[model samples]
Target: MEELLEKLLQAVEFGKVDFKSPYPPQLKGENGAYELTIKALESGVGPQQILENALVPAMDRVGKKFSENKIFVPQMLMSAKAMGASMLQLKPFFTSGEIKTKGTFIIGTVKGDLHDIGKNLVAMMVEGAGWTVIDLGVDVPSARYIEAVNNNPGAIVALSALLTTTMVNMGEIVSDIKANLPTTKVFIGGAPVNNDYCQKIGADFYAPDPQGVVEHLSKLAS
Candidate 1:
């Protein structure tokens, strides 16, 4: 069981999507995350074990590598894809309440900002870290964010903004959520926003990278 889980972790860490994927030459012709996950389940490995033992750990390594600049966005994206393939197989267990996530995360790009790449990466990384992500997509308004927080009590909120012009919207959204929910923790990030802006806007946290967000969430979960 340990060996199988280790292989699954390696597959995801190395960005191997399946037996046919060839991006990482060393892992060619090997069964990847998708196949290995299904195999683990068929062999009666508990879904929670697979999540806590393999997938979460693999993504944690990927996040650290990214933070250290040992890997960049492309590599990180591939690793996320590999993790996503495994997630597809495990999603049913999550839905059936057999595999519990750490918590719910609500994320979106603030109003008037059509950019989604940053938002998407954060969502994927957070989900890989074992949080249930509720992505509201780009150009999301304050009302929408407030509604999502209302629907999902205790959810951590994350706001993204790529354009300076749209950053003001982030402040407004943060204010709206805090004013309405009062208890929901809000995290903010983007190229134009910094820790100062996060503090100025009354957000709970600010992460410069996706890994920062993941690490903070891990601390909260622990």
Candidate 2:
């Protein structure tokens, strides 16, 4: 059982989605995350164990590697794709209440920003950490964020901005959400954002990378 779990984690960490995937030439024709996860479930491995031992650790390694510049966007995307394949098998458990999520996260690219790669990366990392992510997509307005919070009380909000010009919208969105939902924790990040700007905008947290966001969400969950 432990060996199977380890193999599943390796597949995810190396971005092996299934036996048909050929990106990692060394893992050619091997049973990837898709197959291993199903096998683990069929062999009586609990869904929680698959998530805690296999999925979470795999994504954590990917996040750390990304932070260290050991992997780039393409690799990260492939890893996310692998994780998504595993997640499909786990979704039934989640829907059936056999597995529990840590919390709800409402994430979006602030208004005037159309970039989604950064926001999507953060959303994927946060979701990999065991939270429910509500991605509002790009060009989301402040009111939309407020409405999402209103709908999902106690949810954390994360705003993303990729351009210097669009970053200004982050402040407005933060203030609006805070004004309406004073207890909501707002985290901000993007290429042009920094801790100083985060503080100036009155956001609760600022992450330079997806790992930072994962750490923040994990701490919040605990």
Candidate 3:
């Protein structure tokens, strides 16, 4: 069982989605995350073990590689795809209360920012880390964020903006959330956002990459 978990983790970390996937030549024809996950469960491996021992560790590795410049967006995307393949098998477990998530995360690109790739990447990475992600999509207004938070009380919110011009909206949204909820933690990120801007806006956190957000949330969960 331990060895099977290790193989599943390797498949996820190396971006092997299924047996048909050919990106990693060496893994060709072997059962990938998609197959291995189901097999593990069939073998009586606990869903929580699959999450903690395989998926979580694999995502952590991908995140570290991304943060260190050892991997780029394409590589990270592949890892995320592989993680999703495994997640599909685990979803039923989550729904049935066999696997419990750490918390809920609501994410969006602030109003006026039509960008979504950055936000999507963060959402994927966070979800892979065992948190339930509520994606509000692009061009989300402050009120929408507030409403989502109201619906999922105690949920963490992450705001994304790719353009400097549109990034100004983050400040307003952050202020609104703090004023209304007061206790909700708001994390901000994007190509144009910096730690200084995050501080100025009174946001709780600023992560340059998806992995940084994952790490921050992991700490919070711990």
Candidate 4:
């Protein structure tokens, strides 16, 4: 059972979705994260184990690799895809309360940004690390973020922005979230986003990559 969990972690870290997935040529024709996750559950391995032991650590490693410039967006995206494939089998458990997540994460790109790739990657990373991710999609306005925070009380809100011009929207969104839900934490990311801007906007956290965000959320959970 431990070996199966190790294999699942390898599959996710290397971006192997399943037997049919060919992104990583060396891993072709082998059982992927998706299959191993189901198999572990069938073998009576707890869903939380699959998440905490396999998926969480796998994504954390990938995120560090990305932060260090050892991997690029394509590799990171593949890892996220693999994680998502496995997540499909576990979603029902999470909804049923059979498997508990660390916490809820709400994410989206700020209005006028219209970019989703970065936001999507963070959502996947957070979800892979056993958080319930609610992606509000691209071009999200301040009002929309406030509404989401109200509905998900205590949820951490993450905002993304790719364009220099659109990054300004994050300040307004952060302000609105704090105004409507003072206790909610707001995390910010994107190509143009920086810690300086995060401090300027009064956001709680600023992660340059998905891994840092994962670590922050994990700390909150712990």
**Model 4 per-residue lDDT at 192:** 90
Which lDDT tens digits does candidate 1 get at residues 134-180?
Answer: 99999999999889988989999999999999999888898899889
Candidate 4 regions with alpha-carbon error over 4 angstroms? none
Model 4 accuracy (lDDT, Cα): 0.89
Model 2 spans with C-alpha error above 4 angstroms: none
Count of steric clashes across candidates, in order: 0, 0, 0, 0
Which runs of model 3 end up more than 4 angstroms from their true locations?
Answer: none
Looking at candidate 1, what is the lDDT of residue 25?
95
Per-prediction TM-score to the true structure, in the order listed? 0.96, 0.95, 0.94, 0.91
The lDDT values for all models are: 0.92, 0.91, 0.92, 0.89
* lDDT (Cα, tens digit) per residue for candidate 4, span 1-222: 999999999999999999899879989889998899889999999988888899989988988888899998789888888988888999898889888888889999999988998788889778877788899999999988888878888889999999999999899999888887888999999999899999999999999888789888888999
Inter-residue clash pairs, candidate 1: none
Q: What is candidate 3's lDDT per residue for 140-164, written digit by digit as tens? A: 9999999999999999999999998
- Our tally of clashes for model 1 stands at 0
Error of 1 at 125 (Å): 1.3
Q: Residues 78-128, candidate 2: write the lDDT tens digits.
A: 888898899999999999999888889999998988999988989988887
**Preferred candidate (lDDT higher): 1 or 2:** 1
